[model samples]
Target: MQRPATTPLSDTAQATGITVTNLTKTFNTDSGLVTAVDNVSLHVPEGSFFTIVGPSGCGKTTILRMLAGLETPTSGTINVSTGSDKPVTNSMVFQGDSLFPWMNVWDNAAYGLKMRNAAKATIREQVGHYLNKTGLTKFAKAYPHQLSGGMRQRVSIARAFANDPDVFYMDEPFSALDEQNKTILQEELLRTWEESRKTVVFITHSVDEAVILGDEVMIMTARPGRVKKVIEVPFERPRSVLELRRQPEYGEIVYDIWASLKDEVVGAAL
Candidate 1:
């Protein structure tokens, strides 16, 4: 929250989970080659909830895309291994509803497991469980278009969790929902996450969301992005967002992040 400090908050844990070193990305545009991220480095421990918050176009999504193997880094290295044989990120939920409109809730939720050729019984069990967890089991037969925006996002979460990937990468998954729906989904996600304790890297613009859901929150600089600082969350698990927000420390943490973000956000806007 002070000047953009280079000294990251200390966590001496050895890096056995996701490790990134000097990660940079650029794109050759009509104007010229543009660097979007610059020499960013960090490490995420396994089974930890790591959240990232940054100004828009600060390469947040670009960084995530590289981690998910959807894009290649221009330079440097990104090593992410969850030991789940299926894939590194069979578990990503985007800000928008990424569900297939043609598929019903059950099929959509079961899609990943089915693609992995999981047994019918296993698919039924996993998909049914996630759907129920997201409060969508009764609407299992409904297509995406037949459901409300929140319901569709529920299906996306259900599908992502049902896949049972070792790591989850969520990019502002509840950004589009109303406050009530977003709150409900946050609770649902925490409940499911507690059950498995899987690793998750979530990207969000909301400081509250980042603090509430993450074990550690990384703040990124403006365009040509870089890691600014890392702060650890002190709250324990099985957290209720509502309850967590009531504490004085929660308000202070949120204020600190937002206070730190003002300058970067201003730069990004220009």
Candidate 2:
């Protein structure tokens, strides 16, 4: 049984975390009605990183949007109690650059707080803190147009983190970067997650990325997505990406995920 919202959650309940029960979503296109998601459910523990990997058009992003409350589910419940007195706050980082082209990095990073009517001093402090953490302090004055793709994404990450959301929904935020840049950002993200310990639900098609960052990796099927499997990642925290793949179990885990994913990947392509 669940406790009332006002009641404090037990340590076990707090660790039980974000729950998505029987979630479904559908869309109307010119072709016909489409069911993007189908009765999907998940429980992502608080302060743990959860990753979902699937074939293209498999509704991974749709599931993420539903969790973020950006899309209305056809039918389902998403319970995201933070187990804290403060209301749950959620933030999302998109696949492509989402920064305002006209705003400087600092202004863009401060936008969330400004919208919430946070005091100027509070906005200044939080923005400064995240920008420094993301290694963007030097570029704070630059506009989106002036920075490279990877740099622009850093600003978006800073903005999301500075908002200090209780849960983060990331839709392949590092997918656009080159291998070098992606590796760097992935390392930095691990550092941030280690320090902040915020709950994250991340969607990616990259098996390697999913395994490296997720506490648990969920594999979804082709369109009308459903969970194929959920594999617990046992690698200890403060992980080194450079050394991650070298671990003996790393290849085994990645291979298993891919084996489960192969048919769906081919099906999506057809």
Candidate 3:
């Protein structure tokens, strides 16, 4: 397949600082070609929190993997610009903590900085700053096995933020937590995003979570995933989850996206 031309972001769109153009991916199996993502194009403005949500096997994670450079796309382009002077850096937080078993919380959080040849002082400062922000300061000495699931996830979040990445790609980072823990982490994630002013691309199965966190939500089709629709979330920032839920438009948007998703999900199930 021929690669599509790069789509330039418009002046208005450039404010978000991330552009994904004609992004497609295919996998070759013994059975034949399997297209995971097809002709998907999206623009995420700088400092905006964008989200991709779909049912299982819809290629949401595949799209994120491609952006993280872990998976090569069969075609398309991902353009990310942090600023004029600095190179763009991206950090990913996966579903699992993936922390080293022997490493303490602080060490796990400092691992990236260590790899970058950062000074011990710099690593200490960055790790301390983010761990405090994520409320994991007390657990800084605890091992991954000693911490609760939520605490481990906090360590993951701190570690990602400690890298000072220009963009954050999260793949269901809070899906494993209990309801209360998930809600708390979600709020903390937003607070961190607000403070850092980094672009974010999050993947989730929950419509409520997507609506609560994303400035814009992109729905994907099942199996051979494709962009189904891009919906702008018009709610104001510093949002109150309770208040947002009560808004009439909230239910309307959820229903609209669900309607579009249901058939594809059903078809994939068959």
Candidate 4:
């Protein structure tokens, strides 16, 4: 079937970044070779907050791993521009905070910079900046066990941002939080993105989250994932989580994505 045409962003508003061509990934299982992603092709404009949403085990994480160069693709290419004078950095935030038990929050956030051999002065400044931005400055000296789950996740986000990555890949980072914490993190994430304007590829199962957070939402098929649809969110920038959710157009976009995925979701159940 012919996919719907993507709504083009204006040149002035477009982000300049990466393109994926005929991306496919498969894994060798005991039973047989299992295809996780199939011919998935998409472009993520520079500095745009793009998201991919699908059911569990639909290759969302597989795509992210490939982008991070953690996994090689069976066939396909991801083209990233190296035009920036500064080195390009990529950071990921997984479902768990992945903070070290022995390290305090400040230390954890500085780990990435430390790995890069950044100057002690630079590390201190960057760590302090992001911790303050994520509102975790007070808890900087606290260990992971000392903070709440939400605060731990905030540290994770702070760590990622501290590195000043070119692209940020988040896989269901807020899925574990309660409703209130999730909402707060959502707002914090937007604020971070606004200030940094890094290219982001987020994977989630929540349709509402996709609509609220994405510049474009790429909906995938049940398994052997493909780009079933790409829905643009034309709402004004710096949107509030509550206000955008209440918009009629937001509901329309959510329902449209649902209509496209309902059949695939049902098929997966069978």
Best by lDDT: 2
Q: Model 3, stretches more than 4 Å misplaced?
A: 1-16
Which RMSD values do the candidates have, in order? Answer: 6.2, 2.8, 3.1, 5.5
Q: Model 4, range 193-237, lDDT digits (tens) per residue? A: 899788899999999899999999999998888889998999988
lDDT of 4: 0.87
What's the C-alpha lDDT at position 184 in model 3?
86
Model 4 pairs in collision: 15-46
What is the per-residue lDDT of model 1 for residues 80-171, given as tens digits with 9 covering 90 to 100? 65543333553788778799988989999999999989999999999989998988989999999999999998889889899998778898
User: Best candidate, TM-score-wise?
Assistant: 2
RMSD of 1: 6.2
Q: What's the count of clashing pairs in each model shown?
A: 0, 0, 4, 1
| Overall lDDT per candidate, in order of appearance | 0.86, 0.89, 0.85, 0.87
TM-score of predicted structure 1: 0.92
Q: Whole-model lDDT for model 3 versus the true structure?
A: 0.85
Quote the positional error of residue 58 for candidate 1 in Å.
0.7
Per-residue lDDT of model 3, residues 1-270, tens digit only: 232233233434453367778988899989999998988888888889999989899899999998887888899887776545456778899888688889999999998888888998889899999999998889899899999999898888888899888889999999999889988899888877788778899999988899989999999988888898999999998877767889999999889888988988888889
Report the candidate with higher lDDT, 3 versus 4. 4
